[model samples]
Target: MKKWAIYVVLCILTPAIVKAQAVVADSVHMTSKKKVPKVQYGVASFYHNKFEGRKTANGEIFSQKKLTAACNTLPLNCWVRVTNIRNNRSVILRITDRMHPLNKRLIDLSHAAAKTLGYTGHGLTRVKVEYLGKTKPVELNLMEQPAQP
Candidate 1:
Protein backbone atom coordinates (compact mmCIF):
# COMPACT_ATOMS: atom_id res chain seq x y z
CA MET A 1 0.00 0.00 0.00
CA LYS A 2 2.77 2.44 0.93
CA LYS A 3 4.68 1.69 -2.25
CA TRP A 4 1.63 2.49 -4.42
CA ALA A 5 0.99 5.72 -2.51
CA ILE A 6 4.61 6.82 -3.03
CA TYR A 7 4.42 6.20 -6.75
CA VAL A 8 1.24 8.22 -7.12
CA VAL A 9 2.68 11.18 -5.19
CA LEU A 10 5.85 11.11 -7.23
CA CYS A 11 3.90 11.26 -10.48
CA ILE A 12 1.75 14.09 -9.27
CA LEU A 13 4.67 16.28 -8.25
CA THR A 14 6.87 15.61 -11.26
CA PRO A 15 5.02 17.92 -13.63
CA ALA A 16 5.16 20.91 -11.30
CA ILE A 17 8.88 20.38 -10.82
CA VAL A 18 9.42 20.32 -14.58
CA LYS A 19 7.33 23.40 -15.10
CA ALA A 20 9.37 25.38 -12.57
CA GLN A 21 12.57 24.47 -14.37
CA ALA A 22 11.37 25.93 -17.64
CA VAL A 23 11.91 29.66 -18.04
CA VAL A 24 11.85 30.58 -21.69
CA ALA A 25 14.90 32.77 -22.02
CA ASP A 26 13.39 34.58 -24.97
CA SER A 27 16.58 36.16 -26.35
CA VAL A 28 20.07 36.45 -24.91
CA HIS A 29 21.08 40.04 -25.54
CA MET A 30 24.06 42.20 -24.65
CA THR A 31 24.60 45.92 -25.13
CA SER A 32 26.82 48.82 -24.07
CA LYS A 33 25.08 50.20 -21.02
CA LYS A 34 27.67 52.43 -19.42
CA LYS A 35 30.06 53.47 -22.15
CA VAL A 36 30.87 52.36 -25.66
CA PRO A 37 34.19 50.65 -26.10
CA LYS A 38 36.88 52.09 -28.33
CA VAL A 39 36.16 50.63 -31.74
CA GLN A 40 38.50 50.29 -34.74
CA TYR A 41 37.33 52.02 -37.89
CA GLY A 42 38.22 51.03 -41.46
CA VAL A 43 37.58 48.19 -43.88
CA ALA A 44 35.83 45.15 -42.37
CA SER A 45 34.92 41.80 -43.89
CA PHE A 46 33.46 38.39 -43.13
CA TYR A 47 34.18 34.68 -43.44
CA HIS A 48 32.78 33.07 -46.56
CA ASN A 49 33.08 29.52 -47.90
CA LYS A 50 35.56 28.68 -45.19
CA PHE A 51 33.36 29.12 -42.16
CA GLU A 52 29.92 28.55 -43.54
CA GLY A 53 27.79 26.20 -41.43
CA ARG A 54 30.48 26.05 -38.76
CA LYS A 55 29.72 26.55 -35.08
CA THR A 56 29.83 30.19 -34.09
CA ALA A 57 31.15 31.81 -30.95
CA ASN A 58 27.56 31.39 -29.77
CA GLY A 59 26.26 27.97 -28.91
CA GLU A 60 24.22 27.65 -32.14
CA ILE A 61 26.01 26.51 -35.25
CA PHE A 62 26.64 29.35 -37.68
CA SER A 63 24.79 29.77 -40.96
CA GLN A 64 26.59 32.09 -43.38
CA LYS A 65 23.36 33.11 -45.03
CA LYS A 66 22.03 34.68 -41.85
CA LEU A 67 22.69 38.35 -41.17
CA THR A 68 24.69 37.63 -38.03
CA ALA A 69 28.02 38.81 -36.63
CA ALA A 70 30.35 38.17 -33.70
CA CYS A 71 31.55 40.60 -31.11
CA ASN A 72 34.12 40.56 -28.36
CA THR A 73 32.23 42.39 -25.65
CA LEU A 74 28.72 43.15 -26.84
CA PRO A 75 26.05 41.05 -25.18
CA LEU A 76 24.53 38.08 -26.90
CA ASN A 77 21.56 38.72 -29.26
CA CYS A 78 22.28 42.44 -29.37
CA TRP A 79 22.40 44.37 -32.65
CA VAL A 80 25.18 46.51 -34.04
CA ARG A 81 25.90 48.55 -37.13
CA VAL A 82 29.29 48.20 -38.80
CA THR A 83 30.26 50.96 -41.22
CA ASN A 84 33.24 50.69 -43.53
CA ILE A 85 34.97 54.05 -43.53
CA ARG A 86 36.92 53.41 -46.71
CA ASN A 87 33.98 53.20 -49.09
CA ASN A 88 31.12 54.28 -46.89
CA ARG A 89 29.95 50.70 -46.76
CA SER A 90 27.78 49.67 -43.85
CA VAL A 91 25.89 46.64 -42.59
CA ILE A 92 23.84 45.86 -39.50
CA LEU A 93 24.07 42.45 -37.91
CA ARG A 94 23.04 40.68 -34.74
CA ILE A 95 25.38 39.41 -32.06
CA THR A 96 25.11 35.67 -32.26
CA ASP A 97 27.92 34.74 -29.92
CA ARG A 98 30.97 35.87 -28.07
CA MET A 99 33.78 36.95 -30.37
CA HIS A 100 37.07 35.14 -30.89
CA PRO A 101 38.28 34.96 -27.30
CA LEU A 102 41.99 35.33 -27.99
CA ASN A 103 41.93 37.91 -30.76
CA LYS A 104 41.50 41.66 -30.50
CA ARG A 105 39.25 41.66 -33.55
CA LEU A 106 36.25 43.83 -32.71
CA ILE A 107 33.67 41.89 -34.69
CA ASP A 108 33.44 38.91 -37.02
CA LEU A 109 31.01 39.34 -39.86
CA SER A 110 29.19 36.52 -41.59
CA HIS A 111 29.59 36.10 -45.34
CA ALA A 112 26.25 37.69 -45.99
CA ALA A 113 27.04 40.53 -43.64
CA ALA A 114 30.36 41.17 -45.30
CA LYS A 115 28.75 41.07 -48.69
CA THR A 116 26.17 43.59 -47.60
CA LEU A 117 28.98 45.95 -46.71
CA GLY A 118 30.84 45.39 -50.00
CA TYR A 119 33.69 43.36 -48.42
CA THR A 120 33.56 40.25 -50.57
CA GLY A 121 37.12 40.04 -51.87
CA HIS A 122 39.10 41.62 -49.07
CA GLY A 123 37.98 39.16 -46.37
CA LEU A 124 38.62 41.90 -43.84
CA THR A 125 38.15 45.63 -43.45
CA ARG A 126 38.35 48.43 -40.93
CA VAL A 127 34.94 49.40 -39.63
CA LYS A 128 33.10 51.43 -37.00
CA VAL A 129 30.43 49.83 -34.78
CA GLU A 130 27.65 51.56 -32.96
CA TYR A 131 25.44 49.87 -30.39
CA LEU A 132 21.84 51.01 -30.86
CA GLY A 133 20.62 49.76 -27.51
CA LYS A 134 18.20 46.89 -26.97
CA THR A 135 15.24 45.83 -29.09
CA LYS A 136 11.92 47.46 -28.23
CA PRO A 137 8.76 48.31 -30.09
CA VAL A 138 7.60 51.90 -30.24
CA GLU A 139 4.06 52.86 -29.38
CA LEU A 140 2.22 54.57 -32.21
CA ASN A 141 -0.20 57.42 -31.49
CA LEU A 142 -3.37 58.25 -33.43
CA MET A 143 -1.24 60.36 -35.78
CA GLU A 144 1.05 57.40 -36.51
CA GLN A 145 3.92 59.06 -34.69
CA PRO A 146 6.17 56.92 -32.51
CA ALA A 147 5.97 57.77 -28.85
CA GLN A 148 9.71 57.98 -28.37
CA PRO A 149 10.25 60.07 -31.45
Candidate 2:
Protein backbone atom coordinates (compact mmCIF):
# COMPACT_ATOMS: atom_id res chain seq x y z
CA MET A 1 0.00 0.00 0.00
CA LYS A 2 2.90 2.41 0.83
CA LYS A 3 4.57 1.56 -2.47
CA TRP A 4 1.34 2.34 -4.34
CA ALA A 5 1.02 5.67 -2.53
CA ILE A 6 4.64 6.61 -3.41
CA TYR A 7 4.03 5.66 -7.06
CA VAL A 8 0.89 7.78 -7.15
CA VAL A 9 2.74 10.77 -5.69
CA LEU A 10 5.59 10.43 -8.20
CA CYS A 11 3.16 10.11 -11.09
CA ILE A 12 1.53 13.38 -10.08
CA LEU A 13 4.86 15.22 -9.49
CA THR A 14 6.79 13.88 -12.51
CA PRO A 15 4.95 15.98 -15.09
CA ALA A 16 5.33 19.11 -12.93
CA ILE A 17 9.06 18.58 -12.59
CA VAL A 18 9.45 17.94 -16.30
CA LYS A 19 7.38 20.98 -17.17
CA ALA A 20 9.50 23.16 -14.89
CA GLN A 21 12.65 21.87 -16.54
CA ALA A 22 11.25 22.56 -19.99
CA VAL A 23 10.34 26.08 -18.95
CA VAL A 24 13.85 26.61 -17.63
CA ALA A 25 15.36 25.26 -20.83
CA ASP A 26 13.17 27.54 -22.93
CA SER A 27 14.17 30.54 -20.86
CA VAL A 28 17.81 29.65 -21.25
CA HIS A 29 17.39 29.36 -24.99
CA MET A 30 15.72 32.74 -25.13
CA THR A 31 18.55 34.28 -23.12
CA SER A 32 21.27 32.65 -25.23
CA LYS A 33 20.28 34.51 -28.41
CA LYS A 34 22.84 36.97 -29.62
CA LYS A 35 22.38 40.33 -27.96
CA VAL A 36 21.78 43.36 -30.16
CA PRO A 37 24.79 45.59 -30.67
CA LYS A 38 24.75 48.90 -28.84
CA VAL A 39 24.22 52.03 -30.91
CA GLN A 40 24.76 55.69 -30.11
CA TYR A 41 24.04 58.90 -31.95
CA GLY A 42 26.17 61.99 -31.54
CA VAL A 43 28.35 64.53 -33.28
CA ALA A 44 31.64 63.33 -34.80
CA SER A 45 34.76 65.16 -35.83
CA PHE A 46 38.06 64.22 -37.43
CA TYR A 47 41.62 64.68 -36.26
CA HIS A 48 43.54 67.51 -37.83
CA ASN A 49 46.66 67.15 -39.96
CA LYS A 50 48.72 68.34 -36.99
CA PHE A 51 47.79 65.18 -35.04
CA GLU A 52 48.94 62.85 -37.83
CA GLY A 53 52.21 61.77 -36.25
CA ARG A 54 51.06 61.71 -32.63
CA LYS A 55 51.02 58.54 -30.55
CA THR A 56 47.63 57.07 -29.85
CA ALA A 57 46.43 55.77 -26.51
CA ASN A 58 47.07 52.19 -27.62
CA GLY A 59 50.69 53.02 -28.45
CA GLU A 60 49.96 53.06 -32.17
CA ILE A 61 51.23 55.93 -34.23
CA PHE A 62 48.25 58.01 -35.24
CA SER A 63 47.87 58.27 -39.00
CA GLN A 64 45.37 60.32 -40.90
CA LYS A 65 45.42 57.75 -43.72
CA LYS A 66 44.32 54.87 -41.49
CA LEU A 67 40.81 54.06 -40.38
CA THR A 68 41.19 54.82 -36.68
CA ALA A 69 39.36 56.89 -34.15
CA ALA A 70 39.63 58.51 -30.75
CA CYS A 71 36.69 57.74 -28.54
CA ASN A 72 36.25 58.95 -25.02
CA THR A 73 34.32 55.95 -23.78
CA LEU A 74 34.97 53.00 -26.07
CA PRO A 75 37.70 50.51 -25.25
CA LEU A 76 41.01 50.80 -27.07
CA ASN A 77 41.66 48.27 -29.88
CA CYS A 78 37.94 47.63 -30.29
CA TRP A 79 36.34 48.09 -33.70
CA VAL A 80 33.40 50.42 -34.24
CA ARG A 81 31.26 51.31 -37.21
CA VAL A 82 30.71 55.02 -37.58
CA THR A 83 28.04 56.25 -39.94
CA ASN A 84 27.48 59.80 -41.05
CA ILE A 85 23.81 60.42 -40.68
CA ARG A 86 23.80 63.25 -43.17
CA ASN A 87 25.13 61.26 -46.11
CA ASN A 88 24.53 57.72 -44.91
CA ARG A 89 28.20 56.93 -45.39
CA SER A 90 29.77 54.39 -43.07
CA VAL A 91 33.31 53.41 -42.13
CA ILE A 92 34.76 50.76 -39.88
CA LEU A 93 37.47 52.09 -37.66
CA ARG A 94 39.57 50.88 -34.80
CA ILE A 95 39.50 52.79 -31.54
CA THR A 96 43.13 53.66 -30.92
CA ASP A 97 43.04 56.92 -29.01
CA ARG A 98 40.94 58.92 -26.56
CA MET A 99 39.22 62.26 -26.89
CA HIS A 100 39.95 65.37 -24.86
CA PRO A 101 38.38 65.44 -21.39
CA LEU A 102 36.41 68.54 -22.22
CA ASN A 103 35.45 67.53 -25.75
CA LYS A 104 31.74 67.02 -26.34
CA ARG A 105 32.00 65.08 -29.62
CA LEU A 106 31.13 61.42 -29.57
CA ILE A 107 34.15 60.34 -31.57
CA ASP A 108 37.17 61.81 -33.25
CA LEU A 109 37.73 59.92 -36.48
CA SER A 110 40.83 59.76 -38.57
CA HIS A 111 40.96 62.08 -41.55
CA ALA A 112 40.66 59.14 -43.95
CA ALA A 113 37.68 57.80 -42.07
CA ALA A 114 35.99 61.16 -42.12
CA LYS A 115 36.67 61.50 -45.80
CA THR A 116 35.20 58.12 -46.47
CA LEU A 117 32.13 59.07 -44.46
CA GLY A 118 31.83 62.29 -46.50
CA TYR A 119 32.26 64.54 -43.46
CA THR A 120 35.83 65.82 -43.54
CA GLY A 121 34.79 69.11 -45.08
CA HIS A 122 32.18 69.82 -42.43
CA GLY A 123 34.61 69.37 -39.53
CA LEU A 124 31.75 67.81 -37.63
CA THR A 125 28.61 65.86 -38.48
CA ARG A 126 25.89 63.85 -36.84
CA VAL A 127 26.87 60.20 -36.71
CA LYS A 128 25.60 56.85 -35.57
CA VAL A 129 28.21 54.79 -33.76
CA GLU A 130 27.76 51.06 -33.33
CA TYR A 131 29.88 49.05 -30.94
CA LEU A 132 31.25 46.03 -32.74
CA GLY A 133 33.26 44.13 -30.04
CA LYS A 134 37.00 43.98 -29.64
CA THR A 135 39.09 42.61 -32.44
CA LYS A 136 41.66 39.83 -32.01
CA PRO A 137 45.25 40.89 -32.57
CA VAL A 138 46.87 39.15 -35.51
CA GLU A 139 49.93 36.98 -34.85
CA LEU A 140 52.64 36.64 -37.46
CA ASN A 141 55.31 33.92 -37.48
CA LEU A 142 58.32 35.11 -39.44
CA MET A 143 60.73 32.25 -38.81
CA GLU A 144 61.10 29.60 -41.51
CA GLN A 145 59.97 26.12 -40.53
CA PRO A 146 62.19 23.02 -40.82
CA ALA A 147 61.46 20.51 -43.59
CA GLN A 148 59.57 17.41 -42.50
CA PRO A 149 60.56 13.82 -43.55
Candidate 3:
Protein backbone atom coordinates (compact mmCIF):
# COMPACT_ATOMS: atom_id res chain seq x y z
CA MET A 1 0.00 0.00 0.00
CA LYS A 2 2.92 2.40 0.70
CA LYS A 3 4.43 1.69 -2.69
CA TRP A 4 1.12 2.42 -4.38
CA ALA A 5 0.84 5.79 -2.62
CA ILE A 6 4.42 6.69 -3.57
CA TYR A 7 3.75 5.81 -7.20
CA VAL A 8 0.65 8.03 -7.27
CA VAL A 9 2.57 10.94 -5.79
CA LEU A 10 5.36 10.60 -8.36
CA CYS A 11 2.86 10.63 -11.20
CA ILE A 12 1.30 13.84 -9.93
CA LEU A 13 4.59 15.68 -9.18
CA THR A 14 6.86 14.57 -12.04
CA PRO A 15 5.14 16.74 -14.64
CA ALA A 16 5.49 19.85 -12.49
CA ILE A 17 9.18 19.14 -11.90
CA VAL A 18 9.85 18.59 -15.58
CA LYS A 19 7.98 21.78 -16.53
CA ALA A 20 10.03 23.85 -14.08
CA GLN A 21 13.27 22.57 -15.55
CA ALA A 22 12.03 23.25 -19.07
CA VAL A 23 11.17 26.86 -18.23
CA VAL A 24 14.65 27.49 -16.88
CA ALA A 25 16.27 25.90 -19.92
CA ASP A 26 14.13 27.98 -22.27
CA SER A 27 15.04 31.26 -20.56
CA VAL A 28 18.73 30.42 -20.72
CA HIS A 29 18.48 29.59 -24.38
CA MET A 30 16.66 32.81 -25.17
CA THR A 31 19.27 34.95 -23.43
CA SER A 32 22.15 33.17 -25.10
CA LYS A 33 21.07 33.70 -28.69
CA LYS A 34 19.25 36.13 -30.98
CA LYS A 35 15.74 35.11 -31.85
CA VAL A 36 13.67 36.06 -34.88
CA PRO A 37 10.52 37.95 -33.97
CA LYS A 38 7.23 36.38 -34.94
CA VAL A 39 5.18 37.61 -37.92
CA GLN A 40 1.88 39.43 -37.42
CA TYR A 41 -0.93 40.54 -39.76
CA GLY A 42 -3.22 43.53 -39.35
CA VAL A 43 -4.47 46.81 -40.76
CA ALA A 44 -1.99 49.67 -41.05
CA SER A 45 -2.36 53.44 -41.31
CA PHE A 46 -0.16 56.44 -41.85
CA TYR A 47 0.31 59.34 -39.50
CA HIS A 48 -0.97 62.69 -40.67
CA ASN A 49 1.64 65.05 -42.06
CA LYS A 50 0.75 67.41 -39.24
CA PHE A 51 2.42 65.04 -36.82
CA GLU A 52 5.78 65.84 -38.41
CA GLY A 53 8.19 67.63 -36.10
CA ARG A 54 6.01 66.72 -33.14
CA LYS A 55 7.53 64.73 -30.30
CA THR A 56 6.78 61.05 -30.45
CA ALA A 57 5.88 58.98 -27.43
CA ASN A 58 9.47 57.73 -27.29
CA GLY A 59 10.98 61.24 -27.14
CA GLU A 60 12.07 61.37 -30.79
CA ILE A 61 10.75 64.00 -33.15
CA PHE A 62 8.33 62.55 -35.64
CA SER A 63 9.38 62.93 -39.25
CA GLN A 64 7.11 62.28 -42.16
CA LYS A 65 10.14 61.37 -44.23
CA LYS A 66 11.55 58.80 -41.79
CA LEU A 67 10.75 55.14 -41.99
CA THR A 68 9.43 54.64 -38.48
CA ALA A 69 6.20 53.31 -37.06
CA ALA A 70 3.96 52.82 -34.04
CA CYS A 71 2.77 49.46 -32.76
CA ASN A 72 0.41 48.40 -30.04
CA THR A 73 2.80 46.08 -28.23
CA LEU A 74 6.12 45.67 -30.03
CA PRO A 75 9.07 46.70 -27.91
CA LEU A 76 10.33 50.22 -28.53
CA ASN A 77 13.02 50.43 -31.23
CA CYS A 78 12.43 47.00 -32.75
CA TRP A 79 12.59 46.84 -36.55
CA VAL A 80 9.78 45.36 -38.57
CA ARG A 81 9.03 44.82 -42.25
CA VAL A 82 5.55 45.88 -43.27
CA THR A 83 4.15 44.36 -46.46
CA ASN A 84 1.02 45.56 -48.22
CA ILE A 85 -1.15 42.52 -48.69
CA ARG A 86 -2.98 43.82 -51.75
CA ASN A 87 -0.05 44.96 -53.88
CA ASN A 88 2.79 42.98 -52.31
CA ARG A 89 4.77 46.17 -51.73
CA SER A 90 6.92 46.13 -48.61
CA VAL A 91 8.87 48.60 -46.49
CA ILE A 92 11.08 48.20 -43.45
CA LEU A 93 10.45 50.40 -40.46
CA ARG A 94 11.59 50.80 -36.89
CA ILE A 95 9.03 50.82 -34.12
CA THR A 96 9.61 54.09 -32.27
CA ASP A 97 6.31 54.65 -30.51
CA ARG A 98 3.32 52.95 -29.01
CA MET A 99 -0.26 52.87 -30.27
CA HIS A 100 -3.06 53.22 -27.77
CA PRO A 101 -4.56 49.84 -26.93
CA LEU A 102 -8.00 51.27 -27.63
CA ASN A 103 -7.00 52.14 -31.19
CA LYS A 104 -8.19 49.74 -33.86
CA ARG A 105 -5.12 50.10 -36.05
CA LEU A 106 -2.60 47.33 -35.64
CA ILE A 107 0.29 49.47 -36.82
CA ASP A 108 0.75 53.12 -37.76
CA LEU A 109 3.40 54.03 -40.35
CA SER A 110 5.12 57.26 -40.94
CA HIS A 111 4.31 59.22 -44.08
CA ALA A 112 7.41 57.92 -45.82
CA ALA A 113 6.60 54.36 -44.91
CA ALA A 114 3.06 54.77 -46.19
CA LYS A 115 4.36 56.26 -49.42
CA THR A 116 6.82 53.42 -49.88
CA LEU A 117 3.99 50.96 -49.54
CA GLY A 118 1.97 53.02 -52.10
CA TYR A 119 -0.93 53.66 -49.76
CA THR A 120 -0.64 57.21 -48.48
CA GLY A 121 -3.72 58.49 -50.26
CA HIS A 122 -5.91 55.49 -49.56
CA GLY A 123 -5.20 56.02 -45.84
CA LEU A 124 -5.41 52.42 -44.54
CA THR A 125 -3.98 49.19 -45.89
CA ARG A 126 -3.91 45.57 -44.86
CA VAL A 127 -0.39 44.55 -44.04
CA LYS A 128 1.70 41.68 -42.81
CA VAL A 129 4.42 42.57 -40.33
CA GLU A 130 7.52 40.47 -39.83
CA TYR A 131 9.48 41.28 -36.68
CA LEU A 132 13.18 41.39 -37.50
CA GLY A 133 14.49 41.12 -33.95
CA LYS A 134 16.09 43.94 -32.01
CA THR A 135 18.86 45.95 -33.63
CA LYS A 136 20.09 49.50 -34.14
CA PRO A 137 17.67 51.41 -36.36
CA VAL A 138 18.96 51.67 -39.92
CA GLU A 139 17.36 51.59 -43.31
CA LEU A 140 18.08 48.32 -45.12
CA ASN A 141 17.65 47.42 -48.76
CA LEU A 142 14.01 46.50 -49.30
CA MET A 143 14.89 43.99 -52.03
CA GLU A 144 14.08 40.33 -51.59
CA GLN A 145 16.95 38.20 -50.32
CA PRO A 146 19.04 36.76 -53.15
CA ALA A 147 18.33 33.16 -53.98
CA GLN A 148 20.91 30.64 -52.77
CA PRO A 149 23.36 29.41 -55.42
Candidates' lDDT values, in order?
0.69, 0.86, 0.87
Among all windows of 10 consecutive residues in model 1, the one with the lowest summed lDDT is: 23-32
Kindly list the per-residue Cα lDDT of model 2 for residues 1-149, writing each as its tens digit: 99999999999999999999999999998887565447989999999889888898999899999989998777789888889999898877789999889999999999899999997677999999998877632311222345569
Q: Which stretches of candidate 2 lie over 4 Å from their true place?
A: 1-37, 136-149
lDDT of 2 at 76: 80
Q: Evaluated with TM-score, which candidate comes out highest?
A: 3
> Which candidate number would show the highest lDDT if scored against the true structure?
3
Q: What is the lDDT of residue 57 in candidate 3?
A: 83
Candidates 1 and 2 compared by lDDT, better number: 2
- Candidate 2, residue 123: Cα displacement in angstroms equals 0.8
Tens digits of per-residue lDDT for model 1, 81-125: 788766877766678866557766777888888888887777777
lDDT for residue 101 in candidate 1, whole number 0-100: 76
* Full candidate order by lDDT, most accurate first: 3, 2, 1
